[model samples]
Target: MIGSPITPQGVIERKRGIGKVEVEVKNMQSDKDREEDMDRLSDLPDFVLLHIMKFMSMKHAVQTCVLSKRWKELWKRLTNLALHSSDFADLAHFSKFLSWVLSNRDSSISLHSLDLRRKGCIDHELLDMIMGYAVSHDVQQLAIEVNLNVKFGFKLHPSIFSCKSLTFLKLSIWAVPWMTELPSSLPLPALKSLHLEHVTLTAGEGDCAEPFSTCHVLNTLVLDRCNLHHGAKFLCICNSNLSSLTIGSTTQETPYKFVLSTPNLRSLSVMRDPIHQLSACDLSFLEQVNIDVEAYFNAHFQRTHLALISLLQVLADYVKTMILSSSTLKILNGLSTSGSMITQIPCFVQLKSLKLKMKSSSSISDEGVSRIVEYLLKKCPLAKVDVINCRE
Candidate 1:
């Protein structure tokens, strides 16, 4: 009987059982290897994990808590929390979640930055409370964006401005009117950068003072789509350390003037509505200047275009790089000496690089090119020219 069990079919069945055992062994080895790798990752230092977590969004980083017992509490130690809730369907749920996280933050937490943006309406009280918590923790950077159809006022808590560790702040609003005016003097002693978008500064009938008088350490400032009305004269009272500045215009019809005295400014960019005129007092230290002239069908007076040319002429002696676009090129081209009238090209003695942008490629005709070449030769003999079509 033992000799009879050595048939071909019996041998084949024995080999199939051996193959199944080998497959199970290989899978066990793979699972063991994976477990060891996970254990090594869990043993990584807290600081290394925190650095890795910084690259992930707050939601995804928090989800790592479910990875293992060691990771359960590590996400709470992250100092930089950025929560973007653009797809949130319920505003109340979002508000509650924010409140819970902020309230549960540890007292010893040294948060460096906090950014929260939601597409739906946000409760104003919750926003102020969150800002207050950040200030108390000495947050260095804060950014907040909200979307709502209601108009509400915001009061910059004194604690927020007084945080000595704060350096950067950005605020964006949608359809929300800031009913309260920011204090004339912000207490951000260490603040060096500020950005305000879609904000309105409502100065009273006689309030002509500067709004950022206390931001003395500011070196970079950007304002976009902001409305400055009520005879508000924006004056840089003491930005001696300022190196960069950008100002954009909104749809307001009122003509406003900005008085900047940044003696150490190295870069300046200005975009104004064609309807409103702009005049800069002194840009003597400017190394780079960009003047953008937006066309307006109703306000085609071209006074602002002319004023900008005159302003550039004043700064030509100091600027090393210059950029002109839209109506600005047209104005410069109009200074051609073709007619019977005498025309003089404003000379830029120090300009080394010049960039010109036109609305259409055809805008740079033969006459326009010749006039520009002649003007540049007269202004800066060693300058190089670069032409770009914005429409392209």
Candidate 2:
């Protein structure tokens, strides 16, 4: 009993005279603890709070208004607006919410970015409205991805291409639908990066024109699984300022050509299937190249083989870094075994790095691969080579 612990209340019962001071000290400690537990999030500056909400959906950001009076109108000043269809109960609910937010949000501040993703069917008109709003607000970056259950012929608002403030724009439409043919005039002077997925670029009746020719400052372009329809035999990408370019598979298995006017292109990638032909004026500045084209060794084998060789030869002069896919190597190996070995494999003059991507499914013998490797090594004596087996 002599070594007992003393509780705050127990001290009041044992020594009534000194209990007053102990009570005051205990009350002061409780107040300090309460002060530490007070809401510190509400004390953050408006810009800092808006940044924290940038990663949240527009619905969630708006819901934060109910937290306190300080947060009531903070969402209005958000620079980045992210809206997803799944955040609402239905399309109607999403549309109504979007309309209200666009109309009621503070318009004095320029939008930094606008990201809209829709899973199901989205009304093209609704997307157009959003694009119009983004352009008017001087949105610097705009990305819209729509994965539809059914095909949608979605065409962007015309104002988007004229927005001089936009620097980055990406429009991707899944479900194998084509966007209406790109308008012939694309005058995005400030746009530097553009990515289009599953879009179809059609020809103008009997003439051919460059869709991105007017984008003078555009430097990077990616066309993923974009097809050329309406009698368009080839895809023409004539952008002088382009430095990075990627051409994904087209819809045709026939030998479709790419008329590239990228003189200053430094990096290039062609995925999925081989482009039958590549026409370039001058690739003296080309430095990095990645060719990952696949084709069955059927009747089309000869064409595919020739196309790849032609591309390599075109790049052999100035390319410093090069990567060849497993399929491409397999095709080249077939040429060696069939007694059609190229008499003169183009010697890489500036070749510094050479990578050969091999697949286990490649039935080519080790000796056959070695012959090809030896041929490359002999041609490019100063190159560092790596043989990587990227098995499927």
Candidate 3:
């Protein structure tokens, strides 16, 4: 063909053949590319593979040993280890497994987090050892959930409160959940987040703020279903760095007085069964609040319907941007069954926006809302009020 004389027909046939070959070559290349894409996960770098393994439980990670030698020891260097009781056959087996796994893990690697949840007979001593080990290993975040069946609660090891490396901690000690031996002075120097559930909290003779005295970097604190020890029914937090506070009580007659001394608090959320009263909120720096009193209207507590009138008064004192549910408006009505003194409804000086979550059964008409808006306008002339349907 290269030596042949030039002709239109020859040239045309030669060009068509070349085009057909080129299309076939492209088809073959695409097919090969698809196969390469299918094998993508295997070709990923080791660090990416290790990152993916962190999401799986330690048990699952161990099972990956069957896949290849590269994965057999990858879990030993995992930054997070979560060991649950259900994963093992029995408590004894679980204990043995924990010992083996921890011992076999690379001691040179520092742990970022440790989660332990086991419900069984009281084994505070064993737990103390395990938790102590975690602290010594430079664990930054620790979560412990257990059941202490004894009449009295177990006091945690002092190492936990004094741990300078911890940034987050969650303790859910159930049954006998009182922490009797918290240090007179808690010193979580680096703690940024804390959550306590099902724990009985007692105040100490030392400064009421001692328990949180040294948490200079704390940003969030959650107290859920916490029982207060008699004579110590006050939660006094004085952290300057605290920005978010959430308190939830599932029972009536909550004895605790939430004394918020956090001048930098950005948001506050209260979900109460029937919080009789709250200390005057100092909201010079507050920005948002969500108060859910729907639980207070339960029929079991309805008969005693204190109407949460006092609570409403306390909320109006410092609430900033507020979300008002229909039930809240009902309680704020002057003609409510309890005859709340709506005349005492002070203007929200800090509140810039008021959101009305209205229900179809709401007793307040648009006219009533306008009147309330007018009253608030006296204080916040530029206040923004939005009446939104409950469906929204």
Task: Give the best candidate by TM-score.
Answer: 1
Q: Could you arrange the candidates by lDDT from highest to lowest?
A: 2, 3, 1
- Clash counts for the predictions, in order: 0, 0, 0
Question: Between the candidate structures 1 and 3, which one is better when assessed by TM-score?
Answer: 1
**Runs in model 1 with CA error above 4 Å?**
1-15, 148-154, 175-180, 202-207, 272-282, 296-304, 325-345, 357-370, 387-392
Off by over 4 Å in 3: 1-43, 85-96, 118-122, 177-181, 206-210, 250-254, 274-276, 295-318, 326-330, 333-337, 356-382, 387-392
lDDT (C-alpha, whole model) for all candidates: 0.71, 0.80, 0.71
Model 3 has an lDDT value of 0.71
Give lDDT for model 1.
Answer: 0.71
Looking at model 3, residue 18 earns an lDDT score of: 100
Model 1 scores worst on lDDT over the 10 consecutive residues at 336-345
Error of 1 at 92 (Å): 2.2
- lDDT accuracy of residue 278 in candidate 2: 82
Model 1 error, position 346 (Å): 3.1
